[model samples]
Target: MDSIQRKKLVNELISLIEKGNAHVSFKESVTGLPSELRTIIPENLPYSIWQLVEHIRIAQKDIVDFSSSAGSESLAWPDDYWVEPTDTVTDEDWNNSLQQIEKDQQRFQALLEDEQHDLFAPLPWGTGQSLLREAMLIADHNAYHTAEIVVARRLLKSWK
Candidate 1:
């Protein structure tokens, strides 16, 4: 794409990352959540809200890491991407996970916004992956899991 098209695409992806403009945004999904409800596992659901949050954070962090030149080579999927579900998760853990997600979203946006970098070029460490691909992946993955959190919260009547 040309310079203008690239900027427009990056800006669109950034908006998706931060606000989920056309759908329920991540912030909208997680905002105003009660600490007590964070770990609640509603019936039939495989993971709690906290697990989903941590998973999103972990996955997003991995995407950010992989987008950079220094990203690690051996990342274990499922094991590395998810934390064990628990009955007693601390508020600090929840807060830190959300903070990390926000931090990494900013990091991803920075990569997209850096005009010096070629967004379409594959990372040196990867076979065929570009920053643009990763940014889209992060946005897609976050939206899916954030929707899970929102539904879980609604099932438990914790979201209002």
Candidate 2:
């Protein structure tokens, strides 16, 4: 794709990502929360929000790596990948997980440079797809989960 065309596409995708992020962590825009909300998922499920964050973060990191190195794929999920609250998840643990998410997001954004940054070129090592398309998928995936969290919190009366 031409440079101008790519730039436009990238910008549009980025806008979608921004909107998704608002739902994920910025509850202020909403009228109010349900009364109880944990930044991470609850303790009962097999996977707390933190573990999910790790899984997603790892996925994005792999995307960037694959984009650059080509042909690489995700490793097996660690035993902890399926874990839930474990009875003792600290505040720092949650904060650290969220921080990791932010860091991964930034890394994905940085891949967009002034040149050819917007085009969906085929991955260097993958079957087919440009970097921008991969990024778009990531953004959409994030937004979907963010919205899910909102709905789940509402259903569980976990938003506060």
Candidate 3:
């Protein structure tokens, strides 16, 4: 692809991951969430806001790490991607998780923006996964969970 096209694609991926073009962004979904509601699992829902937030963080970090390096160790599926149910979600823990999510997101964006990384080339250590594919995965996964967070907030009457 030409430089112009690559730049445009990078910009679009960044927007999809960071902006609420068609749906709520992760930050917007979790912003101003009441601490009391962070750990409460709404009726019939399998996860709390805290769990979703942590899962997003963990999963995104794993993808970024895997994409940035060859032969990086992959986390165990399901178990490593999610946090256990906890009754004690302090402000510190909550803020740290949020900060990590933002940090790792920026890290992945940097990788995307770097010209050295070929967006379409498959990773040497992966099964034909390209940076472009991982970028889309991150955007899709985050969007799905962010919507869930919004739904949970609505059910808990904390949305808006």
Candidate 4:
């Protein structure tokens, strides 16, 4: 692909992951959540805001790690991606998880922007997954859970 096309694709992928064009961005969904409500599981929901945030961080970090390195280790599905039901999130834990999410997302964006990486070419270490596919997966997965955070906030009467 030409430089111009690569630049455009990078921009679009970044926007999809970072912006709230059609739905709430991850930052928008998590910001200003009350401390008390972060751990409160809304009725019928499987996760709280804190749990969702941690899950997003873990999953996104895994994807970024896997996409950027051939020797990257995969986390166990479901269990490794989510916080335990009985776990408690302190202020430090919450802040750390949020910060890591932002940092790792920036890492993923850098990988996308780097000219050395081929967005469409499959990683030799994986089955048939490419950087492009992983980018879309990150965007989709984060968006899905971010929406859940918003809904949980709404259910708790915390969202604006």
* Local distance difference test values of all predictions, in order: 0.85, 0.57, 0.93, 0.91
lDDT digits (tens) for residues 30-142 of candidate 1:
88888888888899998898889889998888888878667556568779877887888787877787889999999888999998878889888888899888978988898
lDDT computed for candidate 4: 0.91
Clashes, model 1: 0
lDDT of 2 by residue, 1-160 (tens): 6777767766766666555644554222122532224434554543444444555666656666666565566566565233444445556765576666667666666676446443456765578877777778777666655655555465556555
**Which window of ten consecutive residues has the lowest lDDT sum in model 4?**
84-93
Candidate 3 RMSD to the real structure: 0.8
Enumerate clash totals for all models, in the order shown.
0, 10, 0, 0
Cα lDDT tens digits, model 3, 27-98, are 899888889999999999999999999999999999999998986788998888999999879999999999
**What's model 1's overall lDDT?**
0.85
Ranking of all predicted structures according to lDDT, beginning with the best and ending with the worst = 3, 4, 1, 2
Candidates in order: C-alpha RMSD to true structure: 1.4, 4.5, 0.8, 1.1
Worst 10 residues of 3 by lDDT: 70-79
lDDT of 4 by residue, 1-160 (tens): 8999999999999999998569989999988888888888999998888888889999999999999898899899888999875446688988899999999999999999999999999999999999999999999999999999999999999999
Candidates ranked by TM-score, best first? 3, 4, 1, 2
Per-residue error for 91 in candidate 4, Å, reads 1.7
Model 1: how far residue 29 lies from native, Å? 0.9
Question: Candidate 3 or 4, higher lDDT?
Answer: 3
